[model samples]
Target: MTVVQVSAGWVPLAAALLLTVATAAAALDGVLAARAGGRPLGEGLLTPAAETARLFRQRRRTTVAADLPLQRIGGAGLLTAALLMVTVVPFGRWTVADLSVGVVWFNAMDVLLWAALWLAGWGPNSVHPLVAGHRFLAQALSYELPLMFALTTPAVAAGSLRLGDLVAAQSGLWFVVWMPVAFVVFCAGVLAFSAWGPFSAALGGGATGGVLAESAGVDRWLVTAGRYALLTAGAAFGATAFLGGGHGPLLPAWLWVLVKTALLLAVLVALRRRLPVVRPERLTVPAWLVVLPLVLVQLLVVSVVVVVRG
Candidate 1:
């Protein structure tokens, strides 16, 4: 496969545009999900806009001894992490930074969420938010290793950390067909970190919005936007990594990429309505004992295949 280098300026601009689109799409998807579940249209869609306007006029809330700086970091960092992650994601053979270690680069961006969400939860100086932060941290422990192993399966199969090479290796067959477990685990990790679907304990209804219990005004808006952005970015990355990137028949590669990403995001949004939210505590044993081992086995299979093919 030949390397296609895009102009540095054009690539960053394109990535930024796509990231904006993805965030908007995610916001719309959330509204749609609520609508599908019989939520009022005004409440589902216009509510966020109205709330944002209201928040802009409202004063920021603070708790005694609250770490304002840390809270800002947590709220803003989520969007920043999502943007950085998307930079390395190729949309039909174009990426902002098609680094040689693109897979690892992707992993590094994902790991940033551990800090982002934690700060968001802990900085509020409140009990529910602190508990919410602890939940997400425990969640990281359970899912991170499996996620790493899941990522390794494709890297091993393609014999390259570069996403373009990984996509090229799927010209004949997509990795999702063979690495089904990895794809599933990867999606689970996506939902977990993004605080989406049934894995939304960090912002669950039980805790009166969990980590979001105390957030108000722009802080609330930023964190909420960041959550959806994370979901959108995760779905797009999952598409490139598992669903053949942009390779498809009849349509332009970029269109194909967009379609796959939209479908995945729909599935993710629909899942929240369809499935019961699983508490982080319940996820721990299964993630560590069951999912992690399955991910490792998938990695082993990929390794053996690569060796045999060579």
Candidate 2:
């Protein structure tokens, strides 16, 4: 048991370190790609980084009427929340921290989105930021319920809320196989929740960018970094929840986890470029009233399978 426990503990740490390294490499590769296209090395980082540089090179203009403290707090809070959410994610056989109510913890962390966006918007005290915040709020309401239902489906099927157990239960067949509808719903929710393509209404050019328009300097950088980290964590969770976590033929468990996560992130990146944003109002009705019900039904189906199998 001691040996097993030690292995289990080290595995997750190793996986996380590996993931960090891979993210760094991916950033480097982006830089190289940009340079090949005659862009500066600064342009190679994630879109947010490139955007931040652009913001930095431009003159910093502050609205005389803005709440400085709130703006600072908004930027700091976004980074903090994104980092905290990562702690609960399972990288391989273990997570940075595990709780009995891991699924609940994940869901609870998501609630922080409202405060983060609100602060970001309210601090700017500008028309654009205000509009962005309201747009984000509307988008958040649309996607979160379906996301919650999709998240619960796997927990119900595995009969555990712990992310580690959820991954373990997929040793044979992935949840995506049994709960295809839930998988689609979860992926869609992830894209929307992260405000990625097809759900990036909050950040589209006309609508305040939505709240980021008012941000500049380090404040903007932090928010952008947080967004990438959040997306990474979301991809990791999706891999562990629906795809088999670090389980595959031939490769070491850690490598398997890395492979799966990379694949998922690549898919997300591809979708980011390919898909177009949908308006918040149009998405809400379908995502909540339609997708949410389908996910609930998927949960019921998963539960029935678990019971019957047992």
Query: Which candidate should be chosen as best, given TM-score against the real structure?
Result: 1
Candidate 2 lDDT, 1-310, residue by residue in tens? 0001234555556445644743553475476557667898776778444665676786645786998788778766655665666566565554666777878887787678777777778887888778877888898888888888888899998888987788778888988899999888777776665666777776553445677787776777666666555566677778878888777888777667777777787677557655567888898788767788888888888888888989
On the 0 to 100 scale, the lDDT of residue 147 in model 1 is 89
Candidate 1 per-residue lDDT, tens place, 26-118, comes to 556657756887886546655456656888887788988999999889988888888888777787866777789988988898899888888
Per-candidate Cα RMSD to the true structure, in Å, reads 2.2, 4.2
* Runs in model 2 lying further than 4 Å from the true structure: 1-61, 205-208
Pairs that clash in candidate 1: none
lDDT of 2: 0.71
TM-score (all chains, Cα) for each model:
0.92, 0.84
lDDT of all predictions, in order shown? 0.82, 0.71
